[model samples]
Target: MSAGASGVGGAISAHGLGGAKDLPIPSELAIAGAVAALVVSFTVLAVAWREPRYDAATSGRPAPAWLDRLVSSRALAVTARVLGMAFFLYVAAAAVFGQDSLINPFLGTFYVLLWVGIVPASLLLGPVFKAVSPARTISMAFAKVSGVPEGQGLYAYPARLGYWPAAAGLFAFVWLELVYPYSTDVGPVRLWCAAYLGIMFIGSALWGTTFLERADPFEVYSSLVAKLSIWGRRDGVLVLRSPLANLDTVVPRPGLVAVVGVLFGSTAFDSFRESTPWLQLVQSLSGSRVWPDTLALIAFSAGVALVLTIATMATGVTSDTPRRALPDLFAHSVVPIIVGYIVAHYLTYFVEYGQQTLIQLSDPFSRGDNYLGTADLQVDYWLSSHPTFLAVTKVLAVALGHVVGVVAAHDRAIKLLPPRHQLTGQLPLLAAMVCFTVGGLYLLFAA
Candidate 1:
């Protein structure tokens, strides 16, 4: 089995089925596979650089008839839609009925399991999410409300509105979820869910049938990802697709595994960082040294960025591969990234303010205090006690992580895309990294 698969299997066996003490170190075989993936990624880049038109297979007419047929099948699309919607409904219900305690161990564990197991499995099986996405269902509902043909006219828009605005709106919603997780509470969650569905139905009616036909950002992103897979074909060959497609091709699966591992692991690490007084004592010994503080902060941020980037890239790449066709890559990436950030950012609170806040809110029957009553007050208290320098360091750390993640992503893109497109995709990412680095330094020193 692949290293990614093995790591997943091991994690499942250890965490899912076995006790924490029974957890095993990642197998050596898995590490080797990860290394091999990196090697293959570089190899593809080198070859693509030398021969732009190099063909690995003699049969050079677009991918085999079977591959095209499989992707285009309407039955496959319907199945994916059903599955995606089902999963969303299940999670939504769990979140609402089970309360805060349901967020972890139950909902959280299920989410992880689906990503590692179901998502990957769908690449070979079909577009799993497409079969059952809440978003799609909402859109269909909106179509009905707006008097548009059912599922036919939901995406119509003028060129002036552009895809970016829609993309930005989606991103904004995700950011809110990440930055303010309370938005997912039972009442708010249901309201937002209904609102989204209403919007889709209205949009479809106003825009005519063409609205529903409009290309979604998620679909576009997925196509780009699918183009980068080893199974991606411009011709009947196993060669890389667009030279610009390099970002998605390199040791795709292992890269994905690493991203997920780091995200979850870092959150755990942060929890330990906050909860472990011994570690705090060790940190205190550094006495606010710029180097150690900066390093710690940067590591934290980079961990998050890496996780988000990998998850986004993976969704983009694998959406149309032999494995699966995930149409809601945008939503999937947004939800997890935002949720993870909220959890990580609040780690300190969970530790320091536990007795006063989280512990109480987590209890379903608590009557003396509520989230807004005692919990918010405790957060204010903890905030007052935290050192200004610590906050500064944390911000710097986040900036550094973004820089590292952008660079890593750029490197992958440069190696995958054609030489011409290499600079196009990579330059922006590089510029962003530079800007983040400069901003971080300024924050570190100016504060």
Candidate 2:
């Protein structure tokens, strides 16, 4: 993805947060990935299990008692909260007092460590954000001091609001990073963070941690990706389960479709926004480009939701399951596809900038103080340097994600659709998945 530069003092590029785009993935690799996606889609449709293979109640065996105790320990919880708060305050100091330039660690932390690092952290460790979310920690502390029980809100969390707040928040973040012209400017981003923290505090005060779980974009997104990890819980005990089985445990609630739509759509929009054609068109306008970029973001996000809703609901349903409810129910199937494409889109950016952020962190105020002792370290540009290997990895990752998504959807179809219509019901959704995968590969190849 390529864009005009946005940061102060010429430190950042127009392409938003990433420094330089990897060379467009070779066309041959893109074609190979698209072909693999097609083969996996039909293969799963043909030979995959006809019966539903996962159940939260019976899928996994509990971990050993010692491990469970260690993981669930109060000390560990308290330690995590302390660390989260400390890190938040440290970054707050930077944004409040540091230089308004690229040298400021605040920009890198916000753009790189948070925006990109969350994906891999969630993939490897289940719901990593939930454990370390500063807002959640602060809200819990307030509750304790106020003599309120944890998770007890003034009113029950509205089930109908499930994940919608998070969808909005995620959209706002992408808009800030990709659409907002002064995104890298210290003041605007700091203000945005302040508003976000304020809202999270207010929302949680009203609805308890349930608000954080559902409304916090990073938490929701991380938790969604965490579903694809081997870690899970059954009957209050941690257990290891296959990714597919773990993914099946996702209890689809209202706005689940919107959440997935924003996640996938925003990533696609990131690539689309940077294309030469879009850049030329938007730049040619005499007025501000903000209007066009905002509309494109909205279109991309809403388009994904619309397509998914239609695809999932197009199927014939049993009397017990309403067609209207199918979209959210089937939303979990797209999580892998989103994760795969995100990897393709952000792999180099994350690896390179993530290291850069760490080094920058040592000199948060840009005075060249090496507080964390990482000031002398150099970012290894190996991934960016080896464009060919990076391209192949991206293609393979996308192809693998497509295969898992297809299998997950197939299992769900058998469970939800009438026996007579199960296979037929899946065709539209399968086609939608194929379109998404192919379209993603095209972005990789062309952009």
Candidate 3:
């Protein structure tokens, strides 16, 4: 057997750790944390909306001094623009030079990472990409072209509808990723990418010049951070002027990192499991039974729910109601939806393919191959040569996985966060982060 095939095969056979019927306690615990986060976010929002004073701490604040420097730094702006241009260029090159066959794995993996990981994480992190966003970079380029002002006062908060819309949009994105596998040919992929880029460009055009002045979610979050960092000062202006900040002001909570880690880790785990033949083999052997599959499916659903709930709680806790606040909307509604998309998409892959498919794909290559570099080609040809029904089934399985991810993400976001938290908003995002991070690490390395 070729070294590559041999290694893959060895990984597959080592899957005998345990049966799939068992549910890890860590997974269950993580789910509990997710639930708590949701409840807390909702409670806080409800209280704040019902009473105006709840928002007093969060409201008020000129842009921070550092923010002024950050936005106006020519060095940072140039670097961002360069990277953004590079990303688009790479995509274009891949489309032009890469063969269709070569594109599948890359596309599949890329879709998984984008929807399931990056999108959701960004939402949770509060316009995280804005600081280093390619779109932001592109926007900056457009700003230069249009002669927009570049100063601290330029970036301000605009409106608040909670975070639901962002969440919904994220859910839609995940659905697209999951459905891509089953969708007809690669035509959809091209269309999707084009659409994404177009939307980004249009949004940039609309806000590039006035992004700072506009009441956006990011501005609110930044403002809130700046406010919390201020000590012994009621005046927002003075708070911004203080250059030396304490850890408590800057690091909202130690747990927030964990929450981000777990949310992000789920996607990472999905990718690792998908790529690592050994992990798949273990999962297959343990989860092959109907009961095991059912358990896994349930856990997957629970995880999605947890993400939405957490977002709702976080938003509600942070914002005051009847304010129609922009930051609260983005932080609570938008971020969670993104996270949902990521979790749902990856979960779909797990449910549809399970571990058996991976094991089977690794089988033929275990025995020595007569053909030299043609092993992958042989495998592909063999799969194509299979009975029509079998080939179709395999393709459908792959497609279905993506679909499940999208559905779960969207449904969870739409159904869960908004209503519950509006009445009593209080979410513990930082706490959730700590729990998720610890849980994820346990799953990845210790478990």
Tell me, by lDDT, which candidate is best: 2
| Candidate 2, backbone clash total | 4
Q: Clash number for model 1? A: 42
What is the per-residue lDDT of model 2 for residues 1-447, given as tens digits with 9 covering 90 to 100? 322123334433333223224444556657665767666666656675777898888997787888889889999988988998899899999999999877788887887788778888988988889999999998998999999999887988899999999999998888888778887688999999999999999999999999999999989989999999988999888998999999999999999998899888988888777678888998797468789989998998898899989999998898899989999999999999898887877777677666777888898888879999999998787876676677677888788887888888888889999988888888898888878877777766666
Candidate 3, residue 399: Cα displacement in angstroms equals 31
lDDT of each: 0.37, 0.82, 0.35
Off by over 4 Å in 2: 1-25
Question: Best candidate per TM-score, number?
Answer: 2
Which consecutive 10 residues in model 2 have the weakest lDDT in total?
A: 11-20
Q: At residue 400, what lDDT does model 2 achieve?
A: 82
For 1-447, candidate 3 gives per-residue lDDT tens digits of 111011122332111111111123343443444445444544444444343221223433545678655645778667756774675455454444444432222243234333233333443332334454454565666666778754322334234422222333333343343222333134556565566556555644654433432322233233333222332122333223221121112222212322322234333333233334544665768643334333343344346445534544444332333223222222222222223323332332332222323232222223433222433432222321333433233223222322222222223223234566533232343333334433432332222
TM-score of each: 0.40, 0.95, 0.40
